[model samples]
Target: MNTIAEHIADFLKEYPPFDNLTFQELSDIATNIRVINLEKHAVLFQINDLLHDSFYVVASGVINLTTIADAEETIINKCHEGDIFGLRPFFAKNNYMMTAKAREESIIYAIPIAVFRPFVANNSDVLNFLLENFAINSRHAKDNVNSNGKLISDTAFYVDQQSEMQYIQSLAYNNSPLTTESNSIIKDVAILMTESMVDNIVICEKNNPIGIVTNADLSSKIATGRYPITETIDKIMSSPVVTVIENVSLAEAQLLMLKNNVTHLCVTKDGTSKSAVKGIISEHDLIVAQASNPGVLIKEIKRSQLPKDLKQIRDRLSDLIQNSIQKNIPISHISNIASEINLAIIKRAVELSILDLGSPPARFAWLSIGSQGRKEQLLLTDQDSILIFEDVAPEKYREVKDYFLRLAKRTTSILEKVGYEYCPNGHMGSNMLWCKSLTDWTKQYNSWMNTPGENSNDLSSIFFDYEIVFGEPKIEEVIENVIFKNAVNNTLFFDFLGNDALKRNSPLSFFKKFIVEEEGPHKTKFDIKTRALMPLIDAARLLILNANIKGIKNTYLRFKQLAITDSKNAEIYLSCAEAFLTLSKFRTVEGLKNDDSGQYINLREMSKTDKEKLKNALTPMKDLEELIKSKFQLTQFS
Candidate 1:
């Protein structure tokens, strides 16, 4: 009973855009498509050829896209099975800009614009896919054309109108939300969730929503041996639930979720949490609303069992980042999503490493230091990690330490396989110096706090930002408490840290020109990390340490917290937070473009607008450095 059109429709249903379409709709589209076979080296289209009435999707084999330059063919990209090409010309209604030829014997399904245009006009997901493809292809063509090389305005290639319109539309949510009381036992709650066939439940107090618990919370908090089934639900529930009004647009809801880093949004009578719960919108709801997207990337990361699979997910993550940036989404939102994905990848790596090495010999915690600990690692960078195991007796110490060292090596290898490079300075957990017992780590922190020197300062800056990536969190809490207690009373250490914070001079010169490296391989390039971000980072660490604040590792978050605690200097700290976000975004975009760490930036390559933005972002760095100098009384010491 399966006709060729029906067969093709079934295959199309497996991929996106088409996957979002109904079976009937896909069958209709399949009827309009023409299946064409080509031998190797067969030309599908050529440069400057008149626009075809149809666009092609490779059903099998490969298609090579190349441009003719200087009378030579320069390959731009290769389109494999299920990959769509020739869509750009149709969207632009222009002649072919590149030559498409069969790289191998190929079969492509050519769908006419008359048939596809209707679907694109009706389905926002389809339109978004096409627009994204157009943006990517156009950017590639521009880069290839300018390969002889000059910087083109990146702003010109970003497509926002269609995506923005889609985002502003009303979102669909479950009007009748399942709920439970805060006093309910975890076992009862689980039974209720099973009976209702729900993955999440809102905990209410007198018909007012107060918290939420998802299957993830149950698995991580209960099944992990951290809590008992008879424990009260409130113990594991996320408090002060994020909420939205019934009439909120999808974009607004998404922004709220991203801002709060939550997956569930309780739809209330009003927008505030005090209002009665009316409905619920979860990340799964958004996934169904917007086809395979960043949320899907998270799902994929969690599902992946192999390191290579995470690499593929990460590659898709880059595209997601590009699409988000081009759509002009807030940089913080993008960073939050990226950080979640990064953490998920690391978590999975640790899980797999545990399987490889068996269970830990003792309770230990894994710490991600540096940018990752700050939750701002947007690009693939060298890994900086440490391992801390529970203290043991003298005879047991060697056995426990050796077991953790092997585990750390396996974990780091898995992460490296997943694209996180090994630390260049031997800062990873595999090193004996970083992998230590709890007592040893506490002693180490005390030593650094008491003896403030160049080496200690360097270690402080790197180690202080640490966040537990995996394992027993209480171990990290104990270590952090020790560090905080020591740091608060160490005036001499503050002076040393303040001097280190002031090491990077202001990024701007007297005439307001950027003070860039004038010599060496990085001539005229700005080191945004050192000259701009680090001063703010160091200042935040020192000021927060002085305030005896612990567990706030992120620079921007530390500033935000500092603003709330230190009202007089709130304005300066808030400005620094904004500047840090701007600089982080700039670095991420630059890294994506050049395929390298976005540390040093060539001002000559940046557009005028970007240069101006960078200059403005740097203004807060000097003010922050001055605040640090005055607070710690460091002017006389350095």
Candidate 2:
């Protein structure tokens, strides 16, 4: 009943660039499109050929873009369905730089550049998309220049220009530095440092810095009996202070420090000690200015006293994650650094919360469940936690529980203020169900594992991956021992969990295309968390529990351990580990871009390279599901 142009319009509207255009615009563009079908190994455009009047969008099959040099073809990139190619030459008005050929029997829709030019000029989003594509492809072409016979992965070629830009920006320094008279005695300077709460002070003469004294100087000189406390401060100070202009870049300041073999540099209006001292730049200051450095964030977290202070630090951490992803750093490495910072924040929150609620009545362990528990949390999501206290007397049970509930409430509130949203399902430690005594927690785990059902399986999945964020280490050990003892021998419970693991089917359809949401608010989008990540997580958890493994809570680590223990399926387990890392990296990048939970991914927004990478990562998931079905004997239950 519909014309071919209308059908093409329907499909085009589902993807970006066209998706950014209005319905009428899309219909007009579709009306002018010429659909061409090519056989396998057919050429679409050749190198050095005059540019065609139109560019192409692959509607089906794959196309390989390559260059012929030294009489051989070098593949630069592969374009799959919904991907655009040969667009750059149209814009540059130059001959085709590379040849585009159909890798398989394919159908492509060629749209005249003149018809698309209006949208590019009018729609900012469309223009940006085209520009980004051009920049990325240009970088790829440059990288392939020296690859004589080999292909370089895109991940290996991305350079971190952001860090270089930061290095060139003006460095920030401490303006109001502590100072003392040059003739002051060493003992007097020590007292001044104590009163001002400063580790270092500048020696001033007529409002100009002549030398500097630091805690290290005091320790190595005065405290070691090399100099007397009664000696003048200048006698112990490092004279002839190294100075740099206040406007110098961070890289320049660092170079000055290294060249002089000093840890501190005085900043002056001019680049010499003759000018007035405006500020002081220390090695520590340089470290802090590089906000993306995890070490700097950790130190800041430790020094923070208020919730607002931690909120600022968390905001900076988001920048760090973005920079790390841009540099193509390994996701596992990034997650570990982020997890450490997250733990530090929670620990600081607990310390401050105790001050608010008076001291705790008894010792209790704080557990971080869900993503934070597995050490995979990159962006802040909902807070899933539990509170376990040491057993109390029957008469004192109510009093103890009441005290911990107030403590949990204060801590969760502080964390929420610091950017971790409270769990939508009320699974936080503040909830009575999750806040319990040691004996009670043990009983909870036993009951959940022994009884196999929908509710128990749901609870088990959330609670089982927990790691202690605060309190006595032994409390965590005891709880984990209880879980392994109960779960290792529970056959019925394994079946329940295995069935739950397979609840979300593989993300690919019968034709090996993505099985995106068909309708509702998430139409044409994929739930990466539930479809790709959770299934892998659930599968790993079940496998680790069956093996009676303890102390490894992270999903990737669990798979690695499974591979080590069961060599029969080691290959599949290892592949799943790699797949999990890649998928997590993708989700984090998307989340950072949209400022959301990174749960729903719009397939239309992704580049062809990213889509292909995602599909490759998800391929192992189907194999993993098949393995679970055969190993757990889940065939009978479902």
Worst 10 residues of 2 by lDDT: 148-157
TM-score of 1: 0.56
Q: Score residue 248 of candidate 2 by CA lDDT.
A: 60
Each model's lDDT comes to: 0.77, 0.80
Which window of ten consecutive residues has the lowest lDDT sum in model 1? 148-157
lDDT of 2 by residue, 100-183 (tens): 899899999999977887787567687656543432422345443432212222211122222232333355678998888888
In Å, residue 24's CA in model 1 sits off its true spot by 43
> How many clashes would you count in candidate 1?
0
